[model samples]
Target: MFDSLQDKMESAFKNLKGEGKLTEINVAQSIKEIRRALVAADVNYKIAKEFTDKIKDEALGSKNILKSVKPGELMVKIVMDEMTTLMGGQATGINVKGNPGVVLVAGLQGSGKTTFSGKLALFLKEKKSMKPLLVACDVYRPAAIDQLTVLAEQIGAAVYKEPENKNPVSIAQNAIAYAKGHSHDVVIVDTAGRLAIDEVMMTEIRNIKSGINPTETLFVVDSMTGQDAVNTALAFNDVIDYDGVVLTKLDGDTRGGAALSVKYTVGKPIKFASTGEKLNTLDVFHPERMAQRILGMGDIVSFVEKAQDQFDEEEAKRLEKKIKRNKFDYNDFLQQVNQIKKMGDLKSLMGMIPGMGKAIKDIDINDGAFSKVESIIYSMTEDERLKPEILNMSRKRRIAMGCGHNIHEINMFVKQFEQMRKMMTQMSKGKGMERMMQQMQQKR
Candidate 1:
């Protein structure tokens, strides 16, 4: 998640930390370092230069004006502002205005188009209270339809698919009519993807665009692809002129180039970012938060907003009751892990936390980390899962052998689980959890 870019930018600011005042020479040197850092992050050459130039001017202008703020703090503020401007200065949202409003999802192969479609449908259904129909427009691959079906089922959204229809335009049109008949408020069309930008593919998508006239046509591109992603975005924008962009796979080792310059290059805002393959990992793009993240200041506000959107009130109350009664079990622990997984992969989500990114940047955190824990938990009998305290050494060893894990690992996990349950039960019994819930409800 732009780990290298964040490291370089943080290094750039370290040179100015001990300085007494923001002089012309010191400001120039710091801005130079910032520009180099952006270049290292694969940002476009001219945009990086222009961005730092603005920061330089701002830094110098603020030096003699503000007396209360320290030089380092002022410099950080200047850089944060310039970075925000570089990445569109404001957040944009997807438009679902029309009755049975249509949102066309277009992206390159493996860009997570189908997965994002499912996530968006669930977001609309749960967060916005809109009945959404998932339309399978990828007629090229039969498995694409199946993929959407699985995701749609998991999200509890209705799906429309025509396995025999070779034309995507027809499928989408029929799906829209079906949604109207079924009283669905929104229709999300998951279109086909290409290996690369091509004329035939562009023409076909353009024809579909002309037929559907979608309320929001999103150009989904892989942020990991860097400059090529921007180029593909420009190509697609030229043909269909999409409403917004979707940067997918930001949970991967992205260089931060595409996310940095896509809005500037295509002259369209990036409305959503698909951080992972999970159906609930989609987030509305916010330039200020992203700039803060790039500068190594965590975006806790955006993180909380994402959780709030996905968190169900009734489920939270049920979990609260369970924790208060000290009835938390391995099943509840597994459910919590699944919720975190849906927010994004564990590594990426942890990286978004304030200082954890710097601490764990070198570590390889992947899906395999969850696999071991899941296997160990699955090997436990239902009785053991319900009452973890009853697991003696013999029982623990047997469970360890059943899961093919070491006894030490199983013991460590159980210890952590027990500690977590204790902390949660304490919180549930006190006002701390109530206070937090009140604050969250107020925000809503």
Candidate 2:
């Protein structure tokens, strides 16, 4: 996401490498490079300068206090703290708390507002245990209602839209009333967007906000717009005074300017970040976690949270029993793969692990990587899926033809699956660790 900025920041830290302590000379050299990195990431030069200046002061002030810490490590700590503060020190949650909490969504054209509306509905539905009504108030664009309807269908949320009603304010008010009658606890009103800032769009959005009296108003912006995104946010805030910001298209070639500068310029916390096109890819923005990722320190906590979301306690217990009995078959394997897919894209999930981002930066890992294995599993009959040992040579050949894979590929997959099942059984029985210790002692 911020690959270029991450590389440049790494280079900046190299200046302090092998140094005994932080000095004015080395600190200035590093700060200059840090400022250059921020500017290259499309951050405002003025904000970058002020940001690095704070880092310089912090580094110099703590030079002697932490003599035991390495020079490079100390500088990284100082910069991480400053960057977290620059990006709104903590996560700010949206207020969806009312009889029927209303959220007003605003942004420029092509900022993914409608998509985010659907994602927000799914997030609230799955995470917050609240029923969210997706209100399609974007009456300007063609088929905008249909798009929202499709998204709402995907998330299984109720959508309120007046196909013939052009008045957004009335549509929003009516949507809230509908939500109350339908027992929807939250209402997300997706409003129209403009190609550029204009009075007409502003007035329409202001009127909608006034009519709905939303518990929270969010300004969604395309993060790939760089500093222009920040400027647009400021313009919108001046009009409607949004409660928070939402950064979309964060998985694109974003230079990190919008995320780094929006809070400082618009005086609003970034409430959410849309990493991928998947509705499940929405994340609550955490400034400290983001700073760590920008500095090449992966967000392990977020990775765990994503996994935990897909985790089912009863399913885990069943799978554990199966593995312990060496009964983990194609069915179990397929189920595990589906759960991982629900977490997010493989590349993004890996990026959340510590030290995995740079390792996989150049690798072309995606959800497609699972297609071959899935095809193979899908080719198997229900009986074959439930029983691994029943696959004979003839059965393997038939399955290979069904899955469009070669016989050798099917054989290799079967062999690997058996090995994995055996190892899991052994581990569950406490024999795997004991065997590993014996092997180590024998090697010694």
Candidate 3:
């Protein structure tokens, strides 16, 4: 996402490395680098300068106060704090509190408004346990209604659309009334967007807001647009005075400009961040976690939260019992893989772990790897999946033929699976750590 910015920020911190304490000379050098990094990431020069000035003052102010702390570490702390403040200091929650809360979504064309609408519907449905009604108000676009309908179906949310009704305000009003009667707890009206900010688009959105009187109005923008995204957000805010901002396509070639500059420029908290195309990839924007990620310190808290979302206590108990009995078979392994897939994209999930981002930056990790493993497992017979010990050489040959893989690949997969099963069994019995210590002692 912000790979380039992360690398540049790391370089900025390296200026303070091996120093005894923060001095004006060294702090200026590092601050200059930080300013350059922000500017390179498409942040406004004025904001960057002011941001670095605050950082410089904090660095010098804390030079002697934290003598025990390393110069590099202290500078990192200061920058992290400043960055968190630059973005919204705390996470902002959407207000879906009314009787069928109305949320009007406004943005430009191709800003991912419709897709984000779907993601938000899914998020509210699954996370908040609210029934959201997706309203298609993009009457200008010919296929917008169809796209929203498909998304609503995918997320199992109700969608309101009037294909013949070109008036978005009327459509939105009717949708809210429908939501009231249908017992929908939330109404997310996705309004029409233009190729650029124009009077027609602005007027339509404003009228829709006036008609709906939404509990929360969100301005969605494409983060990949860099500074233009911030400018667009400001424009929208000036028109409708939106309650919050939503950054979409954050997993693309984003420079981190929009996320860092939107709140500062438009005076609105970032409510949501949409990454990847998966409907489940929507996340509530947390500034502190984002700052940590930008500074090469992985967002472990978010990582744990994602895992918890997919965690199944009963399934874990069943797996633990099976592992302790040395019966963790291919089916269990496949089920575990599915659970991990539900956590999000493999690369992004791994990036959340501390020190793993840089380690896998150059590696081509994708969900396709999981597909290969799944294909092999699917090729196995039901008996083979239940009992791993029965797969001999002849069985391996048959599986290889079934999965379109050679004998060597099947053999390697089986060997790796057996090793993993054995390790899991030992771990479940609390002997894996002891065996590792013994091996280390032997090596010594």
lDDT tens digits, residues 153-183, model 1? 9999999988888999999999999988999
lDDT of 3: 0.90
Better of 1 and 3 by TM-score: 3
Poorly placed runs, candidate 3 (over 4 Å)? 431-444
lDDT of 1: 0.86
The residue-level lDDT of candidate 1 at 440 comes to 80
* Candidate 3 lDDT tens digits, 1-444: 799899999999998888888899999999999999999999999999999999999999999998899999999999999999999999999999898899999999999999999999999999999999999999888799999999999989999998998889899999999999999999999988899999988888888898889999999989999899999899888899999999999878889889888888888999998888889999999999999999989999888788778766567667777888999999999998998998877888888898988888888888787887888899999999999999999998898888898999888989999999888887868866446434434443
Ranking by lDDT: 2, 3, 1
TM-score of 2: 0.96
RMSD of 1: 2.8
Of the candidates numbered 1 and 2, which has the greater TM-score value?
Answer: 2
Model 1 has a clash total of 0
lDDT of the candidates, in the order given: 0.86, 0.92, 0.90
Q: Name the TM-score of candidate 3.
A: 0.96
Off by over 4 Å in 2: 431-444
